[model samples]
Target: MSRYAEYRALAQSLGVDAVALVPGPNFVRLMKQDFHSHERPLLLVIPAAGPVAAIVPNLELSSFAKLGFEGEVFDWMDQSGYAGAFAALARHIPLGSLAVEGQVMRVFVHHALATAFPGLKIVDAEREISGLRLRKTAEEVAALEGAIRISELALAEVLDDVRIGMTETQIEGHLIQAMFRHGASELAFGPIVAAGENSALPHAHARDVPVQPGDALLFDWGARHGGFCADITRTVFVGHASDEAQAVYETVLQANLKGHEVTRAGITAHDVDDAVTGVLEASVFADRIRTKTGHGLGREVHEAPYIMRGNRQLLEPGMVFTNEPGLYCIGGFGVRIEDDMLVTQDGCRSLTTFPKGLRILG
Candidate 1:
């Protein structure tokens, strides 16, 4: 079978004539190359039972040629625009109904296709298309491990340097530099270095506010290496911890541990989240719960098989996801412990090894 067999099968299953791809995780996975998605448009079309085709930018022809793609290339120039190229592709393949990555493709490209192939049917297959990456291969797991190793090293360095009174943004600067120094190709996302009450916000941004004694310092960050991503979050207390802070921290920690204990192949995603969230729901801080248990993690930080209530997707060996359980009290503080988990035959293994026990920092 050709490499396009799976995609063609997916297209046929989705009841679409072809599947269209833009520059994103799915694109990079199949082509083994990355491209910038700017003003220019680049597209690849795979029909259910025929040869594939592409509309390439004139400038990218040389780079696209390296992929050894067995298809017709309809190249277009900047001055002339991509309409002609899309028009040519329309004539070549004559697609009736097509599947597309709704999250990645831009409106301009959709409009261009609609204009070129008038009366064409475009179906948003974001979930079906991205679901292909739900499971990790051995090689992909190695890349994720490399990313997590670099992130953990950087976090350790930042914690050692974190003293009372340092601004949140200052600490963020230390983190970004340390990730590169420890050998990271790129950041998975902007690092979150919220301090004190700011930590109460699940996705808080670092600010100029100085860290104070008896404050919660939260760091949610990761590094991207070898086309894979690592997402880990650790919350530490600066100086002394209040009685309420310690209670909340311990509660969140237990909930995180529960996620590790219940995950395994053959279990449903809902089961894991229910077990993890149950611990928090039974706690005195139950009202403090602000988010779901976690999300699937891989080439993109968030993907399919979301760990939450109402999702019945079964966990399978080789699937990886984040086991993050957090509790937030708006205007007071928050505590969250996140770890990347790989589902195995018997159970799950945590990819994050940084200590989870409560620690007091200077």
Candidate 2:
């Protein structure tokens, strides 16, 4: 069934008059089009039974028309204000209770929608909609794999230019340039280039501090390909590795591997988090943990099926997420190993192949 058809069925099951989408990933998935956030509100409503309708800005009519929209379109110009468009859409669709992206739709848009249909109920169906994009198709997995390969290659190229006197920000520049040179369409997120004390800050902003000989330089970054993303982290020594650093690295590496080992169909997300965190809690570096083990990764850097404590979402085939576990010691050093994984029929397969073992780089 088409995505719209599937959504219509879901809305019918929930007894909602329609399922609405705003400008974001859900819009991209259903419409195969990109819509930017503007002062004028744009909404696409797929009723339980009828054609899909939209409330779009007059300037965007051409863009929306390209979708070959099969229903009525209520468009208003900037000078006219959007209230008329909302009212026209309301008159056409006529809602009882409409389902919307509770997490995404803006309050102003909601108010406008409520004003158009008095006594209208707006139900949150974020889960039902987001769930549609949770499991990736074969094409998506391949695109993610391509993105990971480009990210790894870019890191390798930048590593050749890294030296002791270079600041973290300088290294970030080198990495970004390399990512583009290596054919990455876009970056999943800003590359994290941290060293020494800065590395202890899990989500550290790259600073001007010169990398030292004994510093643990943590590099966390990803690349985008075909709209899919890959997130990977690797912590390497600048010149020499200390015993303490090695121990911490090994412990975190074990936790990362444990996270992968415990991931498979039928396993609860909490179980995987518990098993991974268990590996660290059993060690003396337990207090070093500063963040959740990992998070879902795909079109957006972070999505559904987050890997954290108390989440009961089950692992399923085609689901992809990160398996990163880190140890951070304030004013000391930090180590993290992150790899994207795809849940398979039995277990999970790592999408990133960057060596996890300690690498001593200049």
- Scored by lDDT, the top model is 1
The sequence of per-residue lDDT tens digits that candidate 2 reaches over residues 11-31 is 898799999999987888777
Residue runs of model 1 more than 4 Å from their true location after superposition:
none
> What tens digits encode model 1's per-residue C-alpha lDDT throughout 165-197?
899999999999999999989899999999889
Q: What is the C-alpha lDDT of each candidate?
A: 0.94, 0.90
Q: Estimate the TM-score of every prediction.
A: 0.99, 0.95
**RMSD to truth, every model:** 0.8, 1.5
Residue pairs with colliding backbones in model 2 are: none
Candidate that would win on TM-score: 1
Clashes of 2: 0
Which portions of model 2 miss their true places by more than 4 Å? none
